[model samples]
Target: MAEKLPALAFGELTDVVRFLMEIDKLKSIQRRTKVLGTDRQENTAEHSWHFAVAVMALAPYAGDQVDIFKVLKMAVIHDIVEIDAGDVLVYDLVARQAIHSEEEAAAIRLFGMLPDAQGKEFHHLWHEYEAGESAEAQFALMIDRLMPVLMNLHNQGQSWVENGIRLEQVLSRNAFIADVYPALWDHLKNHLDKAHQSGWLK
Candidate 1:
């Protein structure tokens, strides 16, 4: 017979479970970026998972002052607000500003579903990621920005072409990555040059 799992009392565990169930809605939140090697658009959940993994891999490059634990936490919770605000394109400056309040409201509601201390930690980490001021936050943001660029390059700039995004726009939006990770930015620029030459980016 299979081992039976123990039941939990209705308290902190229940709150955590409820929060987990609620965040499951993130899987249904679609993004404009397609999954590389396929035409299907990737969802926020997949993006978060991929981001967390990328953080683990790139933590060594984020400098000695950066906290990997905080970076990882920020990665996982950064997009939970999108469960309510939905995914906005990073390049959409106006749309991003317009949704700031909406995203904050969503963060409050979703993170509040947890027990007080846990909720506060998540909320703080989420805000830290958004602020992008701390070393850890900057590192997290760099990887966050890098992922889509890498995906677009691999997928032949599918989303960029479809959205009429220009090379200058992409470079301008992601230029901050150079400040955070110049080596990686240099590597990405090479691929971007090829993409531009191939007319994948206008």
Candidate 2:
């Protein structure tokens, strides 16, 4: 037999439910990377879920001991702001900088929908990811940046080709991955070399 769980107070339940409903909007926010083996673009919600899974899978490769739970939380909440700011290409320096304020505003507004304690936790996790200072944040950020590259690799550099992205650009943008996980960076660079030689990248 299972133990019965305590129920939440009515107000708390309402706030939690409203926050859940609000974050559902994240699914509608499309990203530049297409889903593997599909023509359709992935959504922010899908990316978050995938990121969390990748975090779990890649946790062993992290350079230092990390709180897997904290990293997973960071992955899940990091992009909820995209529900308002929309997805920007990782390679787009100008557009990425332009939306910094909008993304921060979106983060505050969306996370503010939750009750205070829960909201603060979400905000902290999101900001930690943005800062990328801690070991967990670095691991999480590495995976976050790696996923689209993986997607592009599997899909024959679809986004890179479409965006006219050069091999140098991809390397420059994602070189920080080496600081977190050099082995992963080496493996990725090898594939990227093949990709460039195959003429998938400009």
Candidate 3:
């Protein structure tokens, strides 16, 4: 008799389908740069990649002996929910909070699309980033703060000026970075002060 092929498990097949579907969602995030004179939108995948690299490059300064690997994983996938929830600008505090549950729902729907194990792994990571608990969370949050700061500085605070973002608000929002990563904070603060002096923070 000819050899017979083993049957595939339904759960495994479901996982494969889930993974394939989730990959497509990565392209949905879009961010516009008012500061850089560029109106082009950036996808979530690109933003995650940049933040991941930022985490690696700045890992040496992480707070409380962070695990670089965990931090990397967290950065790489933190904003995936934006694929569904959309990128809420940091300056829009009221809108940002209003969408918190919306983003959580997005997280559940998107992360649940993966294989069971992988789905849980990513879901946990997303929750960790949200909770801001571990050293990894702290560092991930710092990088989250840093990328926009650098982008704004490079573009002469275009986003801030366009949105009428105030210096006090910006300072308060970003100050948590100092607690987790002082060196990064120092660098950002210097630029911020310059932006203020240059009439970028009116």
Which is the leading candidate under lDDT?
1
Cα displacement (Å) at residue 63, model 3: 5.5
lDDT of 2 by residue, 1-202 (tens): 9999874456648888878888999999988888888889889999999999998888777745889899999989999898889889888999999999999999899989888999898998888889899988888888999999998899999989999999999999999998888888999999999999999998
**Candidate 3 colliding pairs:** none
| lDDT scores of the candidates, listed in order | 0.90, 0.90, 0.80
User: What's the TM for model 2?
Assistant: 0.93
Ranking by lDDT: 1, 2, 3
Clashes by residue pair, model 1? none
Model 1, CA-based lDDT: 0.90
Which residue pairs in candidate 2 collide?
A: none
* Worst 10-residue lDDT window, candidate 2: 5-14
State the RMSD for candidate 2.
Answer: 6.2
Worst 10 residues of 3 by lDDT: 32-41
Order of the predicted models by TM-score, top scorer first:
1, 2, 3
> Which is superior by TM-score, 1 or 3?
1
Off by over 4 Å in 1: 1-9
